[model samples]
Target chain A: MTLLKAWQMPIILGMVLLLALFLPQMQLNLYVQMVLMYVGINIILTASLNLVNGYLGEFSVGHAAFMAIGAYASSILTVLILPRRWGPAEALRVVPLIGPELANGVYLVPAVLVGGAIAAVAGLVLAFPSFKTRGDYLAIVTLAFNMIVKSLLENSGDIGGLVARLIAPLSASLSADVLRLSDAVGGPRGLLGMSKLTSLFWVCLWVIVSLFAMRNFIFSNFGRGVVSIREDETAAGLVSVNTCQVKVLTFVISSFFAGVAGGLFAHVLQFINPRSFTILKSTDILVMVYLGGIGSLMGSILGAAVFTILLEVLREVIPLVGLSEVWRWVVGPLLLVTLMIFRPRGIMGLREFKGFLPKEEEVKPQAAPAPP
Target chain B: MPQPVTTLVQQTLNALQVGSVYALIALGYTMVYGILTMINFAHGDIFMVSTYLGFFAAAWLLGLALNMPPLVIFLSTLLFAMVGTATLAVIIERVAYKPLRQAPRLSAVITALGVGIFLENFTLAVIGPEPRTIPPLFPLVNLNLSGVFVSTIQIVIIGVSVIVMIILDTIVRRTMTGMAMRAISFDKTIVPLMGVPVDRIISATFALGSAIAAVGGILYGMAYQLDPYMGIRIGWWAFISAVVGGIGNIRGAFVGGFILGFVEIFTPVFLPSSTYRDFVAFSLLLLLLVFRPTGILGRPIVQKV
Candidate 1:
């Protein structure tokens, strides 16, 4: 069968949609549901990150920063805009475009999309540097951006009050109270009072969307250009692939999806701190990407699901043995190390699932080869 | 006018002290990068573990003994910490890194990160989350220089760091072993043809770098309160310094460390608080990389087709 006739993507999408709608009915309790939600979000984060780390061959250590941007953006929007309770009668009066009736149900979808878009814009800042640098330097730049974002978030506040008055107009206030009204973000203590909008349904939905978009993008002309650049930038450039453009595009798209994942996480947990989006979180995503197998999208989803489940299982099982806390820090890193040592190519290498089975023409050698 | 001058001088000394520490750690980073082209992500955690070793030695081993003189106990504990840390570091390289040397850079890096996480969590589990008090080994004597009050320990930290750096510089330039190490760093492929024992040299490099980090860790514990998480922030700063100075250059690491330390210390004085210290250092690093990616003293890395 030709690549065009492959039903893998549609089948995967349909399976995901069905799972999203019905997985909650499974015998698993709320705790299990929350863990699955987390896994779904992580799947989005890891899969998107693999596009850059695996497919584009660029090392970014600040992927969590984009997630932070998305989380903060989505949370702020939800806090400021989402109506707490809208009855059927009142909901119709306030909500624009969709009116009060549909607003109660569909309002979240737009907010989440906007949150992802905001993260993509933030990603552009880091992506622009990829025009010149790659590899370790790119990693350092991303790490720096991560620190910068964290510090900025930590110090963001109003231009008044005791601490604020001291620095005043010259510097941003670090105190939360001074900027209470103006500051959409909840500086230092982090954004709070966010609604628990991230359900298993929403997370799985975005995970499906993120995976589908990335899968399609990878097989697209643009994705091929990215792969070409990854194989050899000089060669790609000679062949008319704009290496810089591809790099920036991949970074932006990856960051955008990472942000959406972040939004899902923030709403699910209903709390976020600067510590939540540290280099540790970035490492977590990187581990998932590498453990799943770098360039394989299916591997990323599998990796994220496995890691999330493993983490939850460890949390549940380790404490029972009286070493619960110790297990948290030890298990993840140990698995990563073991994986690198024993299976550095991960569960899969660069090859996707489609590459596993022989083509119909290959199975039948007498058949004429398909045209390019 | 006097106030500003005094503040400036004090900040400068503070920067020097911090920079000296960064320089000490950056040496380990630079040396490892120089030899293997692999960032030992575990280097920071190794430093963290060494600090805990020093802490344990000072608080439990030496601090308990009443018969021994304070100075002797301090000296012996420092030696023990350095040796223990060096051994741990060398073993890690031998077990974890040596096997992956022929593999991709990512494999070694991931393994290093794994080692780092393991070390950190192991310390956390063993020592508990509570920050252990590092009993002050050196007496806290203050010397008023012109007007600025300086502690004897701070001076000692600066002095020991400079002396060690000088010795290292001498070893690298004047000694045959150092010459061989340099040759290997330049091109490992040709070193075997030159009859140099490349594996031994690489292990020696790891031992030397780890030993330096252990010393730095001890001094760091003396300067500040010891904690398991201490290595992370300082490790990052040292990495920034290593990059700032030019990654593979030893002298550059020293220069970068001091420059970073001074910038971090003084920037807080001009700015609002110390919270932005990382931002400032990293921003400077980014700007420098944007302008001169090779770093201040680093030679431009030429890529092979």
Candidate 2:
């Protein structure tokens, strides 16, 4: 029991490593690898969103905004700036931990973390007004934030034009620099030509990390405080949980992970667009959180994984059944609506798998007498 | 650039025409929210479905016409579309939202989103991704009054909207069902004990809201064109209008819709960037929420410990 508790995380990480090592050897189709990579990225996104909407019981409809920020930040780092300064091989040079594609992704860790840090700051700024909102109102405010983020990014060209007119007195070089930065964003056409640094291994590794972090945190005292607030804010405040601070912290952490996922997505797709991070994108993540048992970390993993795969599979299976391709989009939401109507709690219904429980033997490690 | 008075009149009239439709959609949103305290996210999609209904109704009417006047054709199509949309609303409430009534608030909210997605995608499946042009429901006549040109369709849309809104206001103010709806909105759990048929009144509320959505749909179609995904953005604006006016108050919706419509229209006129329309509108919504969280006419609900 003690061994199992101590070894669980390492075991999970080891499995990810082994999968990474052998996946290339297996010679799987590139499309299949792409699907797997998507699953991993989605798992990270959905799980982080679950942290906000499910665990903290807050409505954060602007998660995709954080994702967008992260994508831009990380992509700018690895694709636009770093490659120019240190060359494409700099990433491989920094940490050649393995051969081929494995080492190719080594530099993404720092870039992705930087992206997460920036997004966490954005989340903090966004959460300032959320101190007053509760439930439905929170949902609306977050949605507005999503819209604002999208519009702001999409209208970068207009902003560039406006700035040029408004700051006509500025020195030519400085104004040129400002306009250059705006142009780099690619406006509505999207920023492309990013290096494909996101490997199946990197995504899977983060998926495990997100799961581990979320689960462990959710079981900690801080996580308990958040859950208590969800159950009753008044009672949690009476018990001295510092409800407002917890809410902000939860949002920051959740946004950070979402940022990480966004960075991975950016590198994987080798493209980023403001439109891809729309209100509908956020809704898609929300659907995953709802479909998964809210507040269950494992459920988040399952929901993102299963839903991602099912979507790809359904495209083929749906048409085979003599239905139009429209059912591909229709069936998912139809299932969700019916599910919410009949089983609103979702598949796991707030229950975690038994494996998540810390072993009884590990709880009193020093106190227990050894068998020897 | 300063516009001539005539052009200004034309712009304001156009604003009013657009605002009337928004008011209608906002009313549906406000009414459902008044009773359920749920946003009814699918309300916009319901409005979208109504346009298709209007299309079908018009086609049917045109086929079976005995040289029917345009006004008569429009009226019959509007009525049939309303009934059809109202029935859909009732069914959606029953299937998607009703069972989750006793569940968590978020469940109902998520279910509402799911219903909206289903409606949108289902419409996309049924109607291919093409924007349908509604045949002119009224004869084209540009009425020139003091150099201001106004289309006959715009006048009919505004006039019809005013009449419908007045009737709805009367229904809510004077009818027994309106009083019952008000009672349910105030205290949903206790209303049944007061001998009100809570379920039936709730159903009636859905029907009323859906009917308004249908009217809004036809007007929107007349003014613009129909697309499967058109409802989401307009629906969002209508929701904002409902919130600004006081979410649960019927009068507030109309007031809010016009405010939003004018803001959206005039912001681009004054500012060089038309893209900032959404940015300005949403900023206004956030500002309103911060100062008067309950909305302009909304009554605050005391938080229970």
Best by TM-score: 2
Give the 10-residue window scoring lowest on summed lDDT in candidate 1 chain B.
B61-70
User: What tens digits encode model 1's per-residue C-alpha lDDT throughout A1-372?
Assistant: 656457765666678767765776675588878888888999999998999988998788888999998888777667765554432223444757763323423545666777789999988876776558555888888888889888878766622334556655665644443455336565578888765666666777777778778877887889899999878998998999988889999999998998888888888898988889988888888888888888898799788988888887888888888884786778778877877777777887676776323243125546688899
Q: Which tens-of-lDDT digit does each residue in B175-207 have in candidate 1?
A: 987998899899989888989998888888888
Colliding residue pairs in candidate 2: none
Global local distance difference test of model 1: 0.81
Question: What TM-score does each of the candidates earn?
Answer: 0.91, 0.94
Error of 2 at A263 (Å): 0.9
Candidate 1 chain A weakest lDDT stretch, 10 residues:
A355-364
Q: Least lDDT summed over 10 consecutive residues: which range in candidate 2 chain A?
A: A357-366
How many angstroms is residue B236 displaced in model 1 relative to the true structure, after the best TM-score fit?
A: 0.9
Against the native chain B, what TM-score does each candidate's chain B reach?
Answer: 0.95, 0.96
Docking quality of model 1: it rates as: medium
What lDDT is reached at residue A65 by model 1?
A: 93
TM-scores of chain A, one for each prediction: 0.83, 0.90
